[model samples]
Target: MLTRILPPPGPARMLIFITMVMSLGQGLWIAINAIYAVTVIRLTPGQLGVSLGITAALVLISSVPLGHLVDRAGPRTIQLWSFLSLAPLTGVLLFVQGFWSYLLVTSVQGLAYRAGNNARKAMIAARVPAGDRARIRAVIRAALNVALAVGACLAGLTLAWGERVGYQSAILLTALCFLVTGLLTLKEAPVPPVPAAAGAAFAVFRDVPFLLFTAVDGLLSTHGLLLDIVLPLWIIHHTDAPRWMSAVLLLINTAFVVAFQVRAARGTDELKSASWASLQGGGCVAAACLLFAMTGGAGLFMACVLLTVGALVHALGEIRHAAGSWTITYDLAPDHAQGQYQGAYKMGVDIGKMFAPALFAWLVIGHGATGWIVLAVSYAVLGAAVPAVVARGARSRATAKVAAGGVTSSTVRM
Candidate 1:
């Protein structure tokens, strides 16, 4: 019965598959970037943090503009360009000597990364059937996480060799992976027609529900960014862990995501008022971050184990949030405005990625552990608050309109 009802694996599935493979390369590249910046480029931790923050900020600035370009040009072009550009940039990293050179190379890499992400998601939305979009997204996320786990292991092996050789090999491998993936994407169909203008493309600002969703999503992204930067650094620098512990810690997080994400999103087949679930997820992440802060003297293995448990809870929240958010976007977006809406959605995501590092860096420097706890608490409060307010407001506004309209009861549009 389930088999009969499920959509055939065709264009949408193929796109997801291809993109997932490409994303594996992206995952591998990002997982070890901090090590490379510190060991190979000879940058201080503070400088590396700032550099990463700046790159992310640039991506944030470029996301909407790139989205508009995708709408005007085509996702295929943008995706292809992004991949090809990454290949050369990774190769050029070998020659980067000074701080100025490092900054220039990283800035370009940021542009490619942002453009690739925007083009990829927009293509999936355009190409995939509406009904199965959420499931497809979940599957892609799970696959991407699994790939990242494998990539992190590989990166560890390379680093075990020596910093310079290891970093060069990883970067080159990533470049090749991008080259191949980008080329395959050339076979993709052109962008589909969107439904309507729905006002200006940027008019997503006027929609209150979307604004709230974007804000929550952006804030949630800080947790994810920390996983990349802070967690591993802590294991390496602060704890009495083996050098390989960073890779092991990542595997735990990715393994949980790969294993449990589907189950986490079991019944969320349609978009509805899910602000409660969103808050729950956010709260879990904030709590995990605080737990992460509390650990002091355990061995690397035990510390990683605790972190893994926290990450599992966090991953569950992440899956639900991803599924719910996409479902909402599909439900709320007017047809012709899908591209614009997607652009708007991505803009919110980028904002989170952009600010997380810079904001957290300052906190870590100024307040130390206390600062970390304060930031965690603040995020937790915001996480729990936004969804509750938005969900309740949606319900009240809906109820009031129904009451004003004479005797009949009616359901609100999700």
Candidate 2:
């Protein structure tokens, strides 16, 4: 089990270690930042929301350009500087006294985070072999999950202490994590920048099929919001499950991902298999949504059972969706432009993050069971549409290849 969960000793292992450390800080910050903002920083809920929203918008706007920078500057250098930049930005959070200052710090931090993230993805593309990319990504993700859970627990302790010092300690610890990760990144083998071609810097925008696929994948990615934002509220307002069940459901989801993400990624190294995984994963999520809907007005025991089962099903879908998305993103991107392409991929996810919370709140929280049904149908439609979109994208690429002369090394399996 350890061997299966751990990547082989090499660059992959090193990357996983970096990811774990990064995610540990992220988990700590995520769990405590809102509370710290509201309680310690004295920001109103609305102010906090505005700051985060603006930060998300900045990240979305900056992702592609930063990614292009990675392609031009080399992944290692960009990643190192981006990671190093984060330490000071995060440390500055300790001194933010007003909404404007908070917003400024967070916005810059968000862009730094996106840049580092894009560089890391490009590094994976450049360093990892195609056959092992998805599997290694899955392992990294599993490690991330475990590390996040541990970090969250530590945050829980800090929160329990209920002192300003504890809050500051968490912030400092997070900043230190960023610093350490940045320094550790220096040990990674340097990846040379891809040679620039005319009109290549922003070419991802010209790929209509890739854009459509990104949009669809972005929509599918909202399954995360469904789990994190929607389900807890559903349990409270719409179902008879105990309030504690929300935490239990989260535990189940985390445990399942840590255990099964690599296993789920086994067959997704190829586009055909990855697309099928996406479809099947969507179906599982849709089924879970239906199960969640059935929990409304149920007996306590029945609702508990339904919620537990739905969480497990959702976890299965989450792992598969993640595995497929990674593989498809890698396979579809041009070899010379992985950074920009990954930036585009991150843009899709950032868009989802910006809009998904409000959308799910209005849709599921406002409409109750009917909202869940609607969400289920939407996921089903989106999942069902993935194969067609992938097929279309593949055909367009093949056509472009033929026009260029014949199939080249960049051509992927149809």
Candidate 3:
């Protein structure tokens, strides 16, 4: 990880640093933001939830258009402006008083964030080659986790300063980080050349099989949300495990991801292999789900043991799924339309996030241990089906190629 980042290419390296900075700064916001609003902004939990929901809606609505912009303007241009804009956008939090003010500012920031994220992903995909992209992304992701951990500690320190000042300083620091990252990204190099687009960005929509692949992969990606939302609720309510163990579970997952991401990314550079890896990862999470379900009748010590083991298994799954998803998302994109393609691809993620809370709650929290069993089976089945989906998409591409008397590389499209 150190080696990859140290001598990294000029533009991409700075971009990677920008990612770390973003993660680090937002890391503080992860746990603190809610509390900040409840106390400093003086809003109810329901109000906060409503505001966040609106932001999510806006992001989902804006993503594809932003991607079109990326393809048209180039990632460098969009990225620089997005990051530069975010500094003031984030700083707006300092003046937010109530619901409307918070919503207005945060929603705009969400636009910047969504567009910036789309541009960043496309830029990275354009910068890196197919073969090296997976490992490079793995290394960058691992570094992000480390940066977030440090930010978590920083957040903890800020909270120690009490309510108003702590929240204000954190927001300011976050804004500064965005500003600096934006400035540094100005030096980024041009993306590797591709044939200029002669058609509308919406060509991606014509590729239906690729969309289904995105849907399935999006479901697989929800494992992170499962950890964030489902696990804690399940641990506290369903299992005999102590609530404190939720933190332990997160730590365990983080440790595994940071330690093994690059290693897990190997052999998944192509679609078929990456799809298989996704299946394996889904299977691991399913198994972990069963383990978690078993802790109901177990004693406290035994429950803790089960939770820890299950968390480790889930972490392994996270590593696998992330590696596979990262590779396919980049590799399957058309170079000329990467911005739009990647942007469209992210719709899958938005779908997953939008559905996870209610869907998982209904399956797990509402139904009890049996819910876990159902979830495990469903997750594994979806994952196992991925290769077939990719195959379909690949065959579709091949057919199109043949119709045009053109050729393509052997890699599957999904």
Which should have the higher TM-score, number 2 or number 3? 2
lDDT per residue (tens digit) for residues 14-53 in model 3: 7668888888877877768888888999999999999999
lDDT of 3 at 36: 88
Please list the residue runs of candidate 1 whose C-alpha ends up more than 4 Å from where it truly belongs after superposition: 1-8, 37-50, 163-166, 193-201, 225-249, 273-276, 286-308, 353-383, 386-412
- Give the range of the ten consecutive residues with the poorest summed lDDT in model 3: 192-201
Index of the highest-lDDT prediction: 2
Tens digits of per-residue lDDT, candidate 2, 1-414, equal: 435678668898889999999999999999999999999999999999899888888888888899899999999999899879999999988888989999999899899898999999999999999989999999998999998999999999999998999999999999999999899999999999998766756989998888988999999998988778888888888887889999999999999998999999998887778888999889999999999989996899999999999999989989998998898898787777889989998888878877788888888889888888988898899899998888788787777767867674432675
lDDT of 3: 0.82
TM-score of 1: 0.77
CA shift of 203, model 1, Å: 2.3
TM per prediction: 0.77, 0.97, 0.94
- What is the lDDT ranking, best to worst? 2, 3, 1
Each model's lDDT comes to 0.68, 0.89, 0.82
Residue 355 CA error for candidate 1 (Å)? 4.5
> How much lDDT does candidate 1 score?
0.68
